[model samples]
Target: MSTTWITRAETAADIPTVHTINAAAFETGAEADLVDALRTDPSWIPGLSIVATDRHDRPIGHALLTRCHIGTVPALCLAPVAVLPEYQKTGAGSAAIHTALRSAADLGEHFVVVLGHPAYYPRFGFTRASTHGIGLTIEVPDEALMALTLDPEHPLPAGIVHYAAPFGI
Candidate 1:
């Protein structure tokens, strides 16, 4: 595992390598396929797909934030975060996630939704979404679906989350 903190956007050359990393990091191919499809979808938000690299700038992890909706309100979705098996727990995934969120904040994005492990995301300031009146169109465990108010001034949006075409949501 590498201790490097560098994170950057995925280039054309990195896409296939990223797909392999995602497929290997997870038990299923869904996430790997999502990454590939999102690249061509109209919903693909440039600069929002990120990869964490080692000292040589070789990608070792990925974290993607794409356009999604909470009711009629625009929001970012964090999904398909994957780290190479060899780099798991090395902070590479976390670094990529943190960087993507921070860049979103700087771009003036206010809200983000995530369907992820209940234990992992809260460390990044995510909270139970229902407390903010946020609900999903699909049935999901209350804790597994979370919302984060990236900008304290803008409260969390309330309603269903509709992901992009690539997500099959």
Candidate 2:
């Protein structure tokens, strides 16, 4: 297991590998199918989908950020982050997520929301979404729903999250 991995925005050529990573990481194909649906959805943001690769340049982890809203304000949603079974706990997923968030910030994206592990997400500066007045239309564990302000100047907006249509929320 190499400690160092390369991260980059996903390309068309990487799609199949990315899908494989997601499908392998989760118990079901739902996450993988969601990725496919999001690609054609209006919420898709081109550069926000990112992957982490091993030395041989095979994608071993994937992360995605797509358009969602907190109330009427624009925001990004982070979902279905996946690392290949062999790559779990190797920091490949973290590298992919960090790279994707940085790319989102670079693109002038302000806030991001993720429904994920409370313990894991906070290391990336994520806090309880409810603390910042952010909620979801769909019920989820309060601690699991995290929010981050990519830019310090822009605070996390307060409201219910409106996820993309394919999310079925």
Model 2 C-alpha lDDT per residue in residues 1-169, reported as the tens digit of each score: 8989899999999999989999999999999999999999999999999999999989999999999999999999999799999889999999999999999999999999999999999999999999999998777999999999999999888999999999999
RMSD of each: 1.0, 0.6
Q: What is the TM-score of each candidate against the true structure?
A: 0.96, 0.98
lDDT string for model 1 (53-108, tens) is 98888898999998999999999999889998988999999999999999889888
Residue 70 in candidate 1 has what lDDT? Answer: 93
Stretches of model 2 off by over 4 angstroms after superposition: none
Task: In model 2, state the lDDT of residue 16.
Answer: 96
Q: What C-alpha lDDT does candidate 1 achieve relative to the native structure?
A: 0.90
Question: Roughly what TM-score does model 2 have, to 2 decimal places?
Answer: 0.98
The alpha-carbon deviation from the true structure for residue 63 of candidate 2, after best TM-score superposition, in angstroms, is 0.4
Clash pairs, model 1 backbone: none
lDDT of 2 at 134: 92
Where does candidate 1 stray beyond 4 Å?
none
Best-fitting candidate, scored by TM-score: 2
